[model samples]
Target chain A: MNFPSKLIEDAVTEISRLPGIGKKTAVRLALHLLKQNEVVTEALALAITRMREEIKYCQTCHNISDDLTCSICKSHRRDRSIICVVEDIRDVLAIENTNQYQGLYHVLGGVISPIQGIGPEELKIESLITRVNKGEVSEIILALSATMEGDTTSFYLSRRLKDSGIKVSSIARGIPVGGELEFTDEVTLGRSILTRINYG
Target chain B: MNFPSKLIEDAVTEISRLPGIGKKTAVRLALHLLKQNEVVTEALALAITRMREEIKYCQTCHNISDDLTCSICKSHRRDRSIICVVEDIRDVLAIENTNQYQGLYHVLGGVISPIQGIGPEELKIESLITRVNKGEVSEIILALSATMEGDTTSFYLSRRLKDSGIKVSSIARGIPVGGELEFTDEVTLGRSILTRINYG
Candidate 1:
């Protein structure tokens, strides 16, 4: 479609480049921005650019932080000996939201996906191994997803860290809290049965 | 949700202020931007701010434009004698996309709606009358939607322009092409029957 202004078209093109946003939504969003107060656009632009330009990953866990070490790693309340390995910062946020896990996080940045040409070398796997070898950790909880890539990363981590003398464990495979038995995937259901605990 | 970094949280807060985005989606978008190259963020920021700060609207039609007079109004190929009245720039785009209408447009900006405290004075109604009085040689097409506000605005315009001696006509109402007989709204169906034209 022919836009009346080049700026509108350029704004739409830039916005549509974002993940999950399409050309039509981009147009709508750009027009919406136009109708809004100028300060709103300014705030959005400033926030995004500031975050992208100044944001840094934690030196210890690779999670997003303003400083070299993340807040989680610095917090005295968190269990430094137990590191819950995760794929990225989103997962860190998700696990933190649970409020059940008191352990610190180890963000891999991403999983090993050969299809996307991403391997262990591309991720923070070497740093993770170093963190393990430095040896203050008692247990490592593999909190990655159950996807093929997640599983591959988990397997690789387990093998490399086997001789480190630290106990490594995967998160439990079980039906979700409110999920129906029939709706549960076969692998999770079957594994839940094999690892079933005595009724309390 | 508690974000690990202040920058992340601030970015999410700003982004979620958008019309349809939520806090969760905002966080996701923020993280996605963080993972991407710095240039992407810079470009997005520049585009949005530039569009907001520099964009201009046409003096004649009030449609968004890069100049004082929009391309549509300045086009020599378009019919200068006829002007189509529309609610906003989007309507101009929709009509232009049809490629059937060759006339220029007069954007009312919005229709009359007392419920929202918007009236003829709140809109560009006076300018439209002024344009008509300035010797528009022929027809003025009321291309507003068929809602109450649209009708109210159309009625007001017709009464206001009646003394100018220019022909004022609304767009025709009929069953939409490829629409099923059983699923049509009663008002539209009744109007279609009352305004039926001969079929081949």
Candidate 2:
């Protein structure tokens, strides 16, 4: 079937590329964007552009930020001696929203997924090790997902840091199998944080 | 609760403004964007910017275009004498996808909704009348929604065009109540087009 103009089609295609967006939904969203006022559309565009141009991965935690270090790392109130390691930045937000954790974060960028060809080298594991080796951190919280990849990464990190005299603990098991922390409701995430158990 | 940095909050808030998006979903989407490659995020931003800066309403048909006039209006193959009246540009795209109607389009910008404070003057009805009065248009198809607002606009237009001796028709009644033409499958829309009835 003949589609709308190429520009419209292109915009739909790009929107569909976003996670959780399908082709039909993308078309609907693109049309909605077109229907909106020019100012709203421009704001959306600017948001996307600024996300790419202005934001960068924090050199220390790997969390997204507008500066060399993420706000959590730069904050004086956050305890630098306790590092909470996570699979991605969303986990950082999930942990932060609890208002429980006062420690700094270390975003792994992703877990060590063998099936997806991702290894420890592909992650921010090296940076995490380097930070731990600096000798000030007393606790390392493994806040990765409750999945095989997350388990593997946790095991690998614990083994690597076995002699570092640092306490390594994984966040608790209330998070469902195959469920992402980002999608889990805040209360459940809070409970998981409150009940975290020692790993190693 | 202490949230992530203000930048992260701002980004999520901006994403939530899109249709059907809520705070949680917006945060998920924004986090995804944050994790994505800079090139992809930049492209999304540029698309939004281009849509705002480049797109404009066609002076004649009121359909959105990147230039002075829409491609359909500028094309020589489309039937200029037959003007298909639609409620919005999305409807124009829906009809265009069918490839059955080669006629020109007249976007009302919206239907007549007295309760919502929309009136005949609020639509592009005057421009439609002016176009028909210029004497080139042979047929005007009222391809509006079957809702109360759409019916009111169709009735108003039919009465206005009655004395002009031009054939004014409303697209067939098989369209479901409160159903937008853009959401109807192509076959149904085409059938509705084929079964249009003459208006007084």
Question: Each prediction's TM-score against the native?
Answer: 0.96, 0.81
Candidate number of the best TM-score: 1
Candidate 2: the clashing residue pairs are none
Clashing residue pairs, candidate 1? none
Worst 10 residues of 1 chain B by lDDT: B128-137
Name the top DockQ candidate.
1
* Fnat of every candidate, listed in order: 0.80, 0.47
Q: Mark the 10 consecutive residues where model 1 chain A has the least summed lDDT.
A: A127-136
Consecutive 10-residue window with the lowest summed lDDT within model 2 chain B:
B1-10
Tell me how many clashing residue pairs each candidate has.
0, 0
Writing each residue's lDDT as its tens digit, candidate 2 over B1-200 gives 24445566667777888888888888888878876788887778776657656667788888877666888889999999999999987788788877789999999999989898998888998999999999999999999997778888899999999998999998776568799989998877887888866697
What is the Å distance of residue A144 in model 2 from its true position? 1.4
What is the DockQ of the complex in model 1? 0.84
Q: Tens digit of lDDT per residue, candidate 2, span A123-175? A: 98889889999988999999988778988999999998888888998877677
- Expressed as tens digits, the lDDT of each residue in A1-200 for candidate 1 is 77889999899999999889998788888989999999999999999999999888899998999899989899999988999999989999998898899998899988999999998899888888888888889999999998899999999999988989899999987999999999998999998999897888
Docking class of 1: high
